[model samples]
Target: MGFSVAYETAELISPALQREMIAVTNELSSDRAWLSCEPPLLMNRGGILGGASKPNFSPHPDELAAAKAAGERDGTLSDLIQILCSVSSQFDVDWVISHDCSNGPLGCIRCGRCDPEVQDQCQVLSELAEELGGCDLDLDDL
Candidate 1:
């Protein structure tokens, strides 16, 4: 009889955090083993997840405008929060922020107009879509 392996995979890790990451990967997978690495630094000499990227204001002018406008009216998270607040009626929903600097993900940004009373979620996103400014990142493309 012959034995064969199907595929191989690896994860990117920082030199300092390699051991920790390996331990986590081992805990998760019985077969897959974690390897050591230096975290991929895209632009500068510094590390990722800690570095910031310049927000592209050109690609998302309209969206940005709406976000800013909505943010001004309420805050940056207003549009997304309301949309979420509505869809979440069925279950206990909490905001999950996927923090990826390379992917340009968002956490919550607060505003003045946020109302805990309102149930209409569509209204929130709609108003937000309108108010998007030069770099309304949270909303979809204009």
Candidate 2:
């Protein structure tokens, strides 16, 4: 497919690393057999839906440096929670959960709040707040 179609899919998915993913895709020289087995690395992927759209999938680049920089920045508990929910359904949980931007079909914002400890703490706090008669926190507001 053309870049235009891929870009449209990216827009629809709202991936956290949109610019980076696009850059990686653009850098690709040609289609190869390795694409299926050794796809590019992505810092954060929302999740792919359609088999028909598989060719559009762009792997992420080596992002250790990027992840470190991202870790230094501030992130939100809500983002982590969303990521957790997305990966919980999968049998290969570690692969999906470890990424900084593993959200559901709607995708994540790669906010760097993917730490398990922090997510657990947020869950506890949310539960406590609910038990204490507080109004439910609106997800959209977070």
Candidate 3:
């Protein structure tokens, strides 16, 4: 015979909390295993068990940059980019960033609202995109 249990994100608690919960459960059954998973990308919200209060959310420029930096530090970004490039080359499809923002891939800057600082930031993103052999797609087309 087999048993199954299912729960929603609201039921997920912190690791320490989980340990306590597991201890309670273990008293009834000692042969159970536990697993946990987190969202792949940096979420704008909804991290807690009950979910975020805001209905809409998106990644900020700084958050995107930090995520990129962390990925590069861990070598995950490089590995993923290499794999993408190889696959894209095989299919002859150009790799590009697609989004609704006017700034670069990170989507931080507005086109007409560009100040000196915004220009510098956009320039940096453009250079980075070029270095990666990818370009930002104009969201206006979509």
Candidate 2 wrong stretches, greater than 4 Å? 1-16, 19-80, 84-114, 134-142
For lDDT, candidate 1 versus 2, the one ahead is 2
Worst 10 residues of 1 by lDDT: 1-10
RMSD of each: 19.1, 18.1, 20.2
Q: How far is candidate 2 from the true structure (C-alpha RMSD, Å)?
A: 18.1
Best lDDT among the predictions, by candidate number: 2
Candidate 2 residue 65 Cα shift, in angstroms, is 45
lDDT of 2 by residue, 1-142 (tens): 2211010122233354345433543244123332212223233334532111122122222332353455522122243244333332221222212122223232322332244644554465445434432333333344
Model 3 worst lDDT window (10 residues): 33-42
Error of 3 at 98 (Å): 6.5
Per-prediction count of colliding residue pairs?
A: 18, 5, 0
The models' CA-based lDDT, in order, is 0.28, 0.31, 0.28
TM per candidate: 0.20, 0.20, 0.21
Q: Judge candidate 2 at residue 4 and give its lDDT.
A: 10
